[model samples]
Target: MIMDIIKQGGRARTTGRPRDACPYPADSRERRAWFEGYDGSAWELSTRVPHPSVALRGVSACPDAATVSNQAAAAT
Candidate 1:
């Protein structure tokens, strides 16, 4: 979605992450989107904001039912 592109790009720019460090596959539209925000003001933002990462994102998608059950069983 457009919002996702904006978000990733913004993060890339703010974090001063290299263009090659895009999480999306090579030659993909998402990578292009990421590059959008990663222009011009990268170092400025990077000085004020941390780089992007899953841990820094703070939230995560839920696992599937089977995976959850497996984890629960393993715990018990």
Candidate 2:
């Protein structure tokens, strides 16, 4: 976990503020990607992509079956 945070350029000193809870996603989605960015004060969702090239970090969980089912149903 520490390694992952470091790889994400988690600079403690620059951050100034103490680290809060890690918002690691508990689910993974196929052909979908989520990103975060800091906007001066705090982190926020940056963007979403249908397919992302980079290997996403802090995503330790796989998407649940029900989520995929619902997405597919909605698409149809």
Give Cα-based local distance difference scores for all models.
0.61, 0.36
Candidate 1 backbone collisions, by pair: none
Q: Which residues of candidate 1, in runs, are more than 4 Å off? A: 40-76
Candidate 2 clashes between residue pairs 3 or more apart in a chain or in different chains: 28-63
Q: Report the alpha-carbon TM-score of model 1 versus the true structure.
A: 0.40
Per-residue alpha-carbon lDDT of model 1 for 1-76, expressed as tens digits? 9457757777766677776776878777666666655542233344433334543685333448668889999999
lDDT of 1: 0.61
Tens-place lDDT per residue, model 2, 11-73, is 432454343423444443210111122112222234332222132553423458668888999
C-alpha root-mean-square deviation, candidate 2 = 14.1
C-alpha TM-score for every candidate: 0.40, 0.18
Q: Cα RMSD to native, each candidate?
A: 13.0, 14.1
